[model samples]
Target: MYDSILVPTDGSEGAEAAARHGLNLATAFDSQIHFLSVVDERSYSSALADLDPTVGEQREGFEQQATEAVECLEEMVTEPPVTCQTAVKHGVPHEEIRSYAADHDIDLISMGTQGRTGLDRLLLGSVTERVVRTSDVPVLTTRHEPDRSRYDRILIPTDGSEAATAAIAHGVAIADRFDSTVHALSVVDVGGVVGAYDAGPGIPELIDSLEEECEQAVTVVEEECENRDIDIVTEVVQGPPYRAIQEYVDREGIDFVSMGTHGRTGLERYLIGSVTERTVRTSDVPVLTVR
Candidate 1:
């Protein structure tokens, strides 16, 4: 379904790993590959002050790195036999990424969760997290390079919200393209409810309520996949959401997880953090976050 794929590079191992997966997807779908390198102008002020007075050494240095990074990605694109384009822009990395995708009609953006030296350790790297939060299109992220073949099984986690339904559409589209199986999973967070209560008097009723929600969530996926004639298996389990997703991935050999940024749980839950972001941080497989 992708027409053009964008890979933002910073000449880091993490970015290179993401590029590998992007190239593989581009090849599979016959899509063009676009490379972007944004020079973080904010990082240059102090360094520029120390450079030679007559020379614009810092700016030139950043441009050179951006150029080389894109060139290296271009070379890597040959095996896939797809057209490749590159650009070096100077601005905030996440803003530049979003702007480039819009201006260039990029269908998908594949990136790494962490840069060469990302600042955040407790959450997703700054630029990536921002892009995931704001991008209008799907953003695919990988912690490590993915296999060069089709995804074996794609998982779509749902909570029956509009955002989750948006993810379900993308998941089905991708699964259709690769002839892959779709795993529709909904986790009832019984642990979350139980942990809030010191005593277990109302826990069973609460668990039952959550289980009903899970069933409805899974039904959303089931209906979508059914309409598309895509093969799908559905599951509803009770546990912590992120842990349940991770365990499901390992148990089913899931190679990709496509999820929404916010679910039926709403913005408040995402404001604190999200199961989606946590999964992105911990999933060994690639994640495609759709907003």
Candidate 2:
């Protein structure tokens, strides 16, 4: 359903990987691709002394880097070419990204969870996390370069909340486009439930009730896939939701993951950090998060 896709880059290998995936989607949908690189003025302004002679030079260096980054991605677009555009802006990286998407009427934002200056750890790059948390549109993120032609299996994890259900249509749309099998998963947070209360006589019955809820949740997804006449598999598992999702991806060889930015317990402003944020931070495959 994407008509215009935006790929924000910092010229990192991670950003390049995301660009490749964004290009693949653009090619599939005959969509226009916009490559944007943002020079984070704060990075230099906060470090250098006020009115320092080097400050202007540092800003110019960053702007040049931004231009080069977009140009590098532009060069990658060829052979059955999709429409492409490029731009560089000076601002907070995440704010500039959101503004670009809004100003360009972007349909999808595909970006990397890590960048050249990213924290070398399991957490997502700060800018990417901010965009994912606050963006008003769907965001597709990845940490590794993916096989562009290999969206053969798509996973959709659900918790039956309105937020979780909101992701199902997007997941199904992508599967429909790729002719991929849909794996509908529901994770029961046994540990969270148990820890919230005493592990006493009522626990077994509570667990069974939770498992039934999980089954019903997956059933909803199953019905959606069936209505679309898409091949589908459904399952219910018990664990921390994000860990269960990662395990399922590894076990099933999932090619992509689609999830809601928030879940049943999500706060109004914060994402369900333990689940969606963790999955975005740690997923080996690309994740499309819908709010």
Candidate 3:
């Protein structure tokens, strides 16, 4: 469980949406929320050279905006007794975010992204992707768009693997908290085997056995969630893991994807390299990845 959450806000719509979810998480754990705004000092410094000698007003404007951003978030921290704290620092956004989280002993970081893709993302270099990749702690991220399902439906993507179960436990808690229904998904990497070759003798039995295996595997996961009284819905899909999860999220109108980090680098989680990394990088909705 998280003890304290750090959220970076640029006052953009994307960041505002993330703050909404961040509050829910902070409330869940009775955790304090740290809101930070980075001044993009590199850009500011470059602009400074071109500013008028009487640029004092411009500097004051920056201070005023930073204060407004912090106060706005403080007002929003109405639930979970979130002890809202804010700081404005001058630096690159991602570096400032990572460094602050490290120094403050932040339990989790929740931030927003535009969810850029392909060339756009390649060109701009996503801050969310970088932070998720480099940060020592877990990250839950959101985009600018608001999700309508919020408290009604939650999605948990599983693979019937031990790693996937990590999300199941957390997902049940999430569903219970919102009094919402839980939909459990296990995406098998069956595409390769299915599309690879021609049928052989007893292929029918093999196919039947495979289907049964999928059912039994997913059933155990669903039953565990049922114990928590979270109305359970289950699905078995075939494709690449990340693609299947993303497609299921889109098709089922999922509000959130709670997952786990299977492999941790070491005690400090100083390094993490897994498929979850790839999924978080591509997911469009908010993701809660627990280790």
Number of the top candidate by TM-score?
2
Please report the TM-score between candidate 3 and the true structure: 0.71
Once fitted onto the true fold, the runs of candidate 3 whose alpha carbons sit more than 4 angstroms away are 44-67, 115-125, 145-150, 161-163, 193-217, 240-243, 261-284
Question: What are the root-mean-square deviations of the candidates from the true structure over C-alphas?
Answer: 3.4, 3.4, 6.3
Model 2 segments more than 4 A misplaced: 46-53, 118-124, 266-271
Model 1 stretches astray by more than 4 angstroms: 46-55, 79-81, 118-124, 196-201, 266-273
Question: In candidate 2, which residue pairs clash?
Answer: none
Q: What is residue 219's positional error in candidate 3, in angstroms?
A: 3.9
Per-residue lDDT of model 3, residues 1-83, tens digit only: 67789988766666667788888877767888998876655443446636664454555555566556667776888755678
- Greater TM-score among 2 and 3 belongs to 2
Which 10 consecutive residues of model 2 have the lowest summed lDDT? Answer: 265-274
Candidate 1, residue 61: the lDDT equals 75
Q: Rank the candidates by lDDT, best first.
A: 2, 1, 3
lDDT of 2 by residue, 49-143 (tens): 35787977767777788888899999999856598999988777889899999999998999999887432111128889899888988899999
lDDT of 1 by residue, 216-282 (tens): 8888888888898989999988777889899999999998999998776531121113788888887
